[model samples]
Target: MILKDALPQGRITGTGSLRTVVQTVFDVLARFRQYMTHPGNSRFEPLFEIAMQKQLYNLLLEWLSGETTNSPDKVETTAVVASWGIFGAAVQWSRDPLHSTSEMMVHRVSEVAAAALAPVLGE
Candidate 1:
């Protein structure tokens, strides 16, 4: 429910860059990082993490598939890999003490994600 709301309006129909998808996801999880890391939620953290990753994967699969891309046939693999990268990074970022590297991390991940979806509309 919260995740759905974090997503951009009309993005469920996909039709956008991988960079945007990844950045949007990062923003959402970063906003809710406290919930996942709180002491009271420690017992359910492991299961929550797994479920979150799976949900993101499936959502990204559908979103990527709907995207109009140069490499239409590779969307499945791209989505799988990109989703993992995005989720993993967010988890690590959430645990870190310093946020000094946040923008750098996002840029780096966004670049890799953009590559997978390249010949992507803007570049």
Candidate 2:
């Protein structure tokens, strides 16, 4: 429940350091991968209903707005939307029979998310 824990807390940090944001993103993705791979869970519907997702998106948008001097709007929107897609893909990747491990899926998704947000974060 890392996402649940993180989202309810609000902003990742007051300074909004790019490193912190990136790590947070990585952590979230990792937790998601863990949840998806759990033996008891077979359906994806419950994950979508978690309020944490919306809160996480809003937090990212807020962070993006504060961190970016130019094109904050564009960056926030793209990052938020791209993150949703990336997370979805990560879930799907976890569920895929070909993927042997959740760890690999988490790493791949985290890398892609970092690359996608790096520019906007000014890192």
| Residue 113 local lDDT, model 1 | 65
List clashing residue pairs in candidate 1.
none
Q: TM-score for every candidate vs. truth? A: 0.66, 0.58
CA RMSD (A), model 2: 5.2
Q: Ten-residue segment with the worst summed lDDT in candidate 2? A: 13-22
The lDDT for every candidate, in the order shown, is 0.64, 0.57
Model 1: weakest 10-residue lDDT segment is 10-19
Model 1 lDDT per residue over 1-123, tens place: 434455566345433444555566666567666676677777777786787777767776676665555475576776677678888987787677286466677777777666754543333
Query: Pick by lDDT: which candidate is best?
Result: 1
Q: Per-residue lDDT for 1-123 in model 2, tens only?
A: 443354435454432333344445455555665676778664764655355456557666776777777586687686577557555665455456365555555556556666777677677
Q: After superposition, how far is residue 57 of candidate 2 from its true place, in Å?
A: 1.5
